[model samples]
Target: MSTTPSTTPEVRDDSRPARIGIQLQPQHAQYPAIRAAAARVEEMGADIAFNWDHFYPLYGEPEGLHFECWTMLAAWAEATSRIEIGALVSCNSYRNPELLADMARTVDHISAHDAGTGRLVLGIGSGWFEKDYDEYGYEFGTAGGRLDKLRDDLPRIESRLGALNPAPTRKIPVLIGGGGEKKTLRLVAKHADIWHTFGDVETFTRKSAVLDERCAEIGRDPGEIERSVGVETVQDAETMFAAGARLFTIGVGGPDYDTAVLADLLAWRDDKNA
Candidate 1:
């Protein structure tokens, strides 16, 4: 198998539009509600939609309604007509890197079928949900150690992608989430096409500086990595945009899967693009 560069691999700009995405948290909602939210977000002109990779809900209640990540992504692929879909950040610990690549490739094909527009952005991060590790029986180690594995495995994942029978119709964009200055941002500089983080404008500005330094240290251009931030409302949207964040993600929860907030986000997206 051909081993691709483990760090800072070249990415082709595929003419995908820049816009907003929402992480449809699987906690409180049922499948029907989640499907409706996906349809509504696409109709509102959001460019992408996402879900978290966790066995249980991250918030609300620990044992609340939840869905698996890759499986749910396959469903989203079939359910939506326009928006790009993937996990906001899939946990790397859950699956072997090669297997994850194959799964992503399969979903990429599923999304592209008949529609001709297939997009899957693999947003991955060092696994952090302790309950998931405990329930699934995977060892929860030091954060640094998990990030180390991520750094080592990224190239392997890319290498395996080339060997898959039907290569993904398009080059999959790798999105790394987290803002750990010592390792996470460094990994972002080295491996990610998109870097996502959660914070306010001040926090984001500070972390961006650290990420820039990491890029310089690694001999990579910081601008090559798309800066993404999670937004909760329109005010946060404007703040993040002003602070140099080009990609904004809002999160909506399940069961009720409301889109009232999404309407405002879409208006802001149009204003920025207009």
Candidate 2:
């Protein structure tokens, strides 16, 4: 799926202002508490809200008060009107591609309001987590195999979105998460509107250059995809932004869903944009 760089201009204008995102970790929090936190983050001026796709907690107790991803997203569609919502990266192996497309379309409609059309970024990636595979009876194939599946399914998901009776409210932006220099980055150059990955300034700079090379091969301007990264503090955000990350996300766990870290990052975003 190589797009000729000369033919495909940038999908997004990078000159746009930087934005902030919040990954309100679903583990260790009650449903009501999570709901409140989601709303509060939007009220606090977050540009987007993300939840992970996993059956169990990624940290702390293995078995904790974790909530399902898509279901919570559905509720968020109605619970909040201002903020966009989606999985940080929905595991491609967990659900059929067509079904996933339908689910996204439904949520897109649900989230659509007078303020705007439905906001759902179709963030997806190959599945990981052996526990999720074992307990759910999903195939925990080799990493390459999973990547192959993801490569095959993305086009199908797009096709399904086009074939739906009522299409998505807007062109759902595809956010592909991962930093695999080979297959993963290639897919991002071909399919993703936003690319999310993690690494320090040096690592990010190297991988980002690789991504641009991939885009050039396919004929798409590297700037077409927005660069996003997870940050633990304002300092990390500064480093990543200096390396070209435009979307900064902060993840917080639990019962309280602390927003202190988010406050600092948000302020940083304002300062940068200002």
Error of 1 at 251 (Å): 1.0
- The residue pairs that clash in candidate 2, if any, are 3-218, 3-219, 4-218, 4-219, 5-219, 5-220
Q: Over the stretch 148-248, how does candidate 1's per-residue lDDT look in tens digits?
A: 99999998999999899877888889999999888898888888889999976767877877777888887998888888889888888777676677788
Q: Which ten residues in a row have the lowest lDDT in candidate 2?
A: 2-11
lDDT of 2 by residue, 241-272 (tens): 76678998988888999999888888888999
User: How many backbone clashes does every candidate have?
Assistant: 4, 6
Q: What is the C-alpha lDDT of each candidate?
A: 0.84, 0.89
- 20: Cα error in model 2, Å: 0.7
Model 1: how far residue 27 lies from native, Å: 1.5
